[model samples]
Target: MIPEELLLKYTAETKRFQKDEIIFSEKQTAHYYYQIVSGVVKMNNFNDDGKEFIQGVFYKNQSFGEPPLFIDVKYPANAVAISDSTVLALSKSNLFKLLQDNPETHLKITQSLAKRLYYKAIIASEISSQEPAHRVLRFIDYLKDDVYKVEGKYSFKVAYTRQQMADILGLRVETVIRVIKSLEKKGDVKISKRKVYR
Candidate 1:
């Protein structure tokens, strides 16, 4: 990730977005480099039947929607605030120049993007071939590190809602609810005050 100082130097201002607000829509021109300073963001799209598909979710200190900027392509999905959020928005050209000046940061960005590509490939296969339980488990496992910082007993909270989980895993929300309840009954996860722990 780009350092805060460097980002600040390039970012003219911090943009604030309310929960559920659209930062940018699908097919919009890619113009800025965005880094989350607080809260969460999700890049997603709707299908023909209006079903949502979540492409990615990012939290504080993370970045999103950079691939299109590099490729000079329109955004493939909409970026929305998952909560009240602040984002540092830099001109794409300035970001590119900054990366050019700092090869180390550029290399880190490359590695990060590559890791995301690999994750997408794995998720695509799971969505196409896995059962609901399998898909749910796989998706949770994928986000385990992000959602939880396990120290002793595998206890961790799920960062997303059931509907968000369904969108990410390509399952119906009802199916996600049933599978989670089943998981809880089977002792695969624990639900405490609506928070899930594994």
Candidate 2:
């Protein structure tokens, strides 16, 4: 991610978006580089049958929709605020200028994008051949270890709702609920007060 000071130097503007608001839509021109300053955002798409498929959920300090900016292509998914959120938006031209002037920051951005690609690969494999319980467990484990960096079993609290998990994993909401409860019975996760911990 580009530092805020640098983004500001490149004329990045702070913008606020409300929950369920569409920040940018699929097929829209990639005009700005978006970085979340507060709250949650999701890049998602809807199927013809009205099923929602979440491409990814982004939290504070994370950047989304970068590939399109670098390649000069339209965004393939819509960016929406999951909660009332604050974001920094920089023009595509300004982002290129900032990167060109800052080699270290550019490298960091590349690494961030690489991690996203890696996560996508893992999800693809999990969705294809894994059983329901295994898929959910693996996804939660990845979030705990790599994304949240929390240690110890059942020490990390899962913040994503069951519906969100189902959307991302390509499972039905009922399946996600059942799998989580099954996981709890098996001692793979701990559920208390309806929140899952792992």
Model 2's alpha-carbon lDDT is 0.94
lDDT tens readout by residue for model 1, 59-154: 988899999999989999999999999999989899998899889999999988987987898899999998998888777776675334354444
Q: Clashes in model 2: which pairs? A: none
Estimate, for each residue in 1-198, the C-alpha lDDT of model 2 and write its tens digit.
678889999999999999999999999999999999999999999999999999999999999999998888899999999999999999989999999999999999998898888889999999999999989999999899887899998899998999999999999999999999999999999998999999
Q: Model 1: runs farther than 4 Å from truth? A: 145-152
Model 2 / residue 180 / CA error / Å: 0.5
**Against the true structure, what is each candidate's TM-score?**
0.93, 0.96
Q: Which stretches of candidate 2 lie over 4 Å from their true place?
A: none
Q: Ten consecutive residues with minimal summed lDDT in candidate 2?
A: 1-10
